[model samples]
Target: MAKQSTLDKNILHFLGPKHWLTWLGMGIAYALSFLPWFIQKFLGKALGNLHRALSPNRRHICDVNLHMCYPEMTIKERQSLTKAHFESMGIGVFEMFATWFQDRSKTISKVSFHNEDVVEKALSKGKGCIIIGAHFSSIDLCGTHMARYIDVHPIYKLQRNPVMNWVMERQRRKIFSKTIERRNVREVIKSLKQNKAVWYAVDQDYGRKNSVFAPFYGHECATISHISRLAKSTQAAILLYDYGRTEKGYFLSLTELEDYPTGDEVQDATKINQLIEQQIEPKKAQYFWSHRRFKTQAIEGTPSPYSK
Candidate 1:
């Protein structure tokens, strides 16, 4: 833990009037994180409702995504799912704060690992394990718990808000074995060569550069087509890391992909995408739907599905 004096020095940069909202938000998150788990759930749902009411654009994005992905769902069912997703997002906020502020043991105690042996077997190989994850509502928070089972390095993207980004990085640095930037491919490869586990999230559209159109939820979505090459280059085991809430609590596990990286980029991308789609089906609402996932059309000049 950082000393109070050091934390105070860190907060000095955000004392200006423009950063008041960030300061207030951080204070609220800090307080909420320490609340009882049950109370946090209730308050998180309420906050989700409030956020849904306030953000039409984001809500619409979710609505569009849900519709495109699950056309079989009736309008009412989709609407309900959308609202529930927002609630999950709201709860995720609490989880994020708790993850950053609470003890590692507290978060680890709350989660159940379904298949740690899978991870162990992968690590048993001389090569490191390449753990690919999707955009779950509480990835970083729950991922911190999953790390208890395996010493996994997480690659994080920088938040646009520098203040919040700094705060998150500080906390993340403490809990994680090592933190790498999402774009730092060289470091990721080097870590794998060192027989270290790295949790790299690959379920988002990073645009056309080094990406290909792959089937995501039955639609052709832009996906990065480098996992196979990455695996081959690093001689690492490829595993899909999955975590979600269930009737019990949060369940997290790793599924090893055997004989992977057939050395076909498109085929490899499709296989990974299919696995993600199947995994996300049960925890539909917990998946991140607010992102403009299909913003980059597979067909050049085609309009984005999320367009108003």
Candidate 2:
């Protein structure tokens, strides 16, 4: 057998008594996975309410985003939307639980696919596909559920908590056809060449590198630009895979973009932001509003609108 390295020993040490609370939280989430759908929804909203009450800074970030994006919205309307965002976020947590412990067949049977012909056509092109994913509520569950329909490889990030990271990797591997590290450009290209759909969330800002400052929701926001490169190199089609929750279960939509990667990076990025807005408009609260979306301003040295 291979000898465990020093880093492995330290991981074992930290995963022991040093992380009791983390373990307890994971345990509770696991146990909650078996609750009936209706009850789980109630408890999830309650948990979200509790979290909203405790997290003022996060709430402030959401408020700032709403003010920027929905300048026309009444303060009352924005406040209501904030509450719904948190509640949906809480319910999203339990959705992860449902995905981890519940029966995949039964859970997926509840999902309805729309405009699936879009994907059918995209795959028919013989080039790979890059799914324009987003950070929406129930992100974990939605990403996992998506693989059921298409042979998708999710571009994943490592959880900050090492112990939880292991858990996430294990769970993703179980549901996803394959998991690709967010930085593994080679694997992404290879998968696309194989005509497999790769899920890529281009909404987040990862500093200025390979990113362009563009107007998103009426604010100058940093947008990832390498997507244009990826699509160009792989000759892969870019499709939007939108997820929505109804009273029954969930629904996903596959939308094929026309005239994308116009060979202009900024134009393509702007189009992405535009498409994301369309996706969020119908389900405002189901989107992740608490993220510091405008952290990186358009101009260098410009102060972030969000409070520290």
Off by over 4 Å in 2: 1-14
Candidate 1 Cα misplacement greater than 4 A, ranges: 1-13
What is the RMSD of candidate 1?
3.8
RMSD (CA, Å), each prediction = 3.8, 3.5
lDDT (Cα, tens digit) per residue for candidate 1, span 152-252: 88888777765687688789878877888877899898888788898888988889996989888888989988778888887899888889877567888
Error of 2 at 228 (Å): 0.8
State the weakest 10-residue window (summed lDDT) of model 1. 1-10
Residue 76, candidate 1: how far off, in angstroms? 0.7
In candidate 1 the C-alpha lDDT for residue 97 amounts to 88
Each candidate's clash count: 0, 0
